[model samples]
Target chain A: MDPSQVDVPPLKDLTIDNITDNVKLINSGCPDPRLKYLLERLVQHMHDFARETRLSHNEWMTAIQFLTSVGQICTDVRQEFILLSDILGLSLLVDSIDHPKPASSTEGTVLGPFHTHDAPPEPNGTQIAHDPAGEPCLVLCTVKDTEGKPIEGVKIDIWETDSSGKYDVQYEGREAPDQRAVMTSDAEGIFWFKAIVPVPYPIPNDGPVGKLLTLLKRHCYRPSHMHFMMEKEGFDHLITALYLRGDPYETSDAVFGVKESLLIDLGKVSAGQAKTYGVKEGGKLMSYDFVLVSEKESRELREKNAMYAMKDLGLRMKLYNGLPIPEVD
Target chain B: MDPSQVDVPPLKDLTIDNITDNVKLINSGCPDPRLKYLLERLVQHMHDFARETRLSHNEWMTAIQFLTSVGQICTDVRQEFILLSDILGLSLLVDSIDHPKPASSTEGTVLGPFHTHDAPPEPNGTQIAHDPAGEPCLVLCTVKDTEGKPIEGVKIDIWETDSSGKYDVQYEGREAPDQRAVMTSDAEGIFWFKAIVPVPYPIPNDGPVGKLLTLLKRHCYRPSHMHFMMEKEGFDHLITALYLRGDPYETSDAVFGVKESLLIDLGKVSAGQAKTYGVKEGGKLMSYDFVLVSEKESRELREKNAMYAMKDLGLRMKLYNGLPIPEVD
Candidate 1:
């Protein structure tokens, strides 16, 4: 049929109330049902947002320009859009939805932009921080399955900011993989490392996102935390962080990455007591136990369980329409 | 007060249900009340949209990438963001809201990307289309006040596509300002020009916006029309178009610029009959009359009237907060 000749109802003049439906109708031809659904909802909500706010033309233009700058500033190493998402708390929301953990297991958080796959593997108890000015600290972690069985030989990736709250990647003259290390758990599912106690610090604030934060009169600080990525042969890979309980920004982490289960106490240790854990005097000690859900159970829970049954229903609708299903991973 | 010492309430873990409130609280410090309201509303609606669609991480990433590409491709001559907005019907929606015309006045449409301020002025009946292949067209227009009194000495900027559905800007070898002309209405508020009968043309489809249209199984064609920017003393400047009735894409204009009042008949004139208007034989004739509201009424209607009282209220709030209010013009 000649689409142009088909008697389409004449569109009413553009209005706040009708614009959403009009845009949805325009996107009705999208072959990808998922994209169509996403776009329709986006248009509906965006139009509603604009109307509800009584957004001026200038405000809308400002948003367009801001988004443009964000896109223009993105590079291989820098993703301003992702940063925007993270600071907006969208990244963490997505993380939680995609990786709902059982009550017995550790919760996941955003895999922040700084994770690198090239950290050198070190034996247990190796010092990951070389900065002598940083306060010495000892971290011990044990990985176990939901049944409380130790998951030995799991590869654990660990990284943390320096005591000054700056990651190695943020330094202009830092060596490769500083303040980061990879290790395999021992027979007892125990992995320990010596490092500096990280301090809360502001995120990079020199770009457009920074300018927006300043305009909002908002601080850009993230709480002190240690990042961990643990993987075992038969368990779901866990990417999370353990934040220091008493950190100044613990209750207000900029990225909303903090979870009650992920907070740990940083116990101050005497010089002689620190020496027992192979750390220098006046250091801190932290011990955490991470529980992983089995891969089979995790997959089944996401695909067939009631927690995500709505998503499953959506996927089934897509399949019924003979559209290609997008890979969740 | 020491911000860090101030006891902030513990944040709930990020979830779909609470992400909106969380983001709103994060933006609570926004000194500019207008920006805060807009951003808060944006966050709420965007979060709601994400949840309503059960948007997957992959789909979200795809959207970010798509927006990034749109921003990267924009240049001085090309505005992909505007194109995106236009294709989605947002530009027209904004225009309609910002420039609400009374029923007696000619409605405004999009100020399309092709408008240039450098169009050379010519006397009435000047032949604007230099292309010999184009069918001759005679445009006769009258400008008037809302009461039908002729308003003389109005500058009318006119432009349109050639018979081949290509604008001068779209042609690599075209002369400067071809197919465009500026003219002034005479003492009687009468204006006339000779040009080609414009053909429906596809918008530039080589960019990300075009790709999006294709993915949506939608066409990018706009109906045959002549753009006009009419300005005179004591009246609001008007940016609008007169679409040729019976055009193939008149009902399906990709930009949603068509209005029932803007459609006009193009009566074919024989060579002998065309001499009356000083046009060559085998041309089309279109007579349109535009009515303009007084500037006083327009301003008062937009500001003090209930239709836009909410926007005025918002403006007052911005003023009270000492934020620079955006210029309505």
Candidate 2:
């Protein structure tokens, strides 16, 4: 619908209090109802924010320039906007809303900006860390349904920061993946991998987001954790991370990704204990059980929140289809 | 302050209801009170927007990508974010709040992204448009205070879209400015100039902002208008534009920059009438008086709204100093 063709009661002398109403009126011509709803909500919130804060002209320009810089710094590998969202806790909120889980199922967290699709497939119990200097650790996990029936062949992509507190992708001129691997559960619905004990690390702070954190007087570190992205047929996909207990930054994970249930202790394992896990040397043991939600149940929960989920399905298709997937050599 | 050093009551198992509170809590360490207030207000609005609309992860990512593109497309001359702000009516809202005026004073509007300081200065009553093919238009204006006493030496920067509905900067490989100039009030506190009648035109629509307008099913044309930026030492700086009466886009300006008081009729004039204004041929006549608020009175109003104005003073100094002024050769 052309704006001139749309009927509007002549909008004149638009005052501060009236402009938002006029904006909503002008946007009433939007063709998509979901887009309309989303835009209306957005307008309400943003306008209210400006009015409540009594945002000055100069301050608004400062924000404009800041957001512009945040955008300009993005590349195929770096996503400053996502980092901004993470630090603001928006990323976690979105995850909680879009992927609600019952207490019986393991909770989910942010899939921090470091996940890569090129992680090499490794056999069960294989050492994922290539660096011999990193403190050795063993992860033991089983995948099962809410009813406790073991579900085999679950695809898992696990990655973590090295002891030096950085992912492989964080290094320049990176060739192959380290401290990360892709594997599947065995017949007994059990999967295990040997890797370095992950360490707490700061997010990329060389960008505007980093500057904002400094301005906020907030630290940039996430608690030490290992990331997991899991999927299996007839089950809901899960993206989560396990925070190590007693990490200094645990209570203040910069991205607000920590969940109480997701915290686990890395027990000190003696050589005899390591031998049971088929390792020759002493190492840390990280053990936990993973729970899955059936696809049908997940769909039912989404239907319960059908207002959002209905639009979400279409958005998912369009987003992934239209989005540019960065080229990885 | 370091994350480990801040005293935070162990935040665990953060749900949607509590995450916002926790975010504000974590950010409470921000040393600047004004910034803290702004961030708190911003977080409240944004979080409420998400929760109220049930924003999905896919939708959030779409916004992230869109904003990134808007930022990526900006250049030395193009400010896509400002255009975005204009179309959303945010620019106008900010102007209204920051530059509130007495009914007698000329109201300010958005400084639409076409302004350039390099506009060559012209003598009063001289022609601004270089193109001979354009329909000549004579502008007559006086700068006066609330008492109707003429004020001399008010510097005015005037610019408008050409007869082809584009700014001089819009043209590819443009060397010098046309349809724009800088001038000052004459001895009688009056200034007159000859220029082409500006035509309604679309803002830069090849960017994300344009796509958003199309998605909203709205036309992109602003009403034909001439922009004016005036500054006099003892008066409040005024940035405004005069909208022509009866323009097709008048009722639905793409940027919402129109006010009833700012609209004027461009009366047809004979060659005889044009000669009186110093134009040699028959053209259109635009006659109006611009009223300016004294600096003292403006400051009083701001002081009345001191909650914002106090911060604005510091922001003005920092914004101009820190902002990169786009260079024009």
Q: For residues A1-329, could you state the per-residue lDDT of candidate 2 as single tens digits?
A: 35557665466678778989888888877877667767877887777667655667889989999999999998766788999989888989888877778789999998878888889888898989877778888888988899998888999999988878888888888888888899898888788989888888899988899999989988898889999988998998888989999998888888999998999988766677677778745568888899989877875675455444434433222221222111220
- Candidate 2 chain B minimal-lDDT segment of 10 residues: B320-329
Tell me the DockQ of each model, to 2 decimals: 0.35, 0.38
Show what share of the native A-B interface contacts model 2 retains. 0.61
lDDT of 2 by residue, B242-273 (tens): 99989988888888998999999987776776
- Please tell me what DockQ candidate 2 reaches: 0.38
Candidate 1's residue-wise lDDT over B16-36, tens digit each? 567678778878767676677
Model 1 lDDT, residue A46, Cα: 69
> What interface Cα RMSD is found for model 2?
6.3
Cα DockQ of the candidate 1 complex: 0.35
- Using Cα atoms with residue i matched to residue i, what is each candidate's TM-score against the true structure? 0.80, 0.88
Per-model B-chain TM-score: 0.82, 0.87
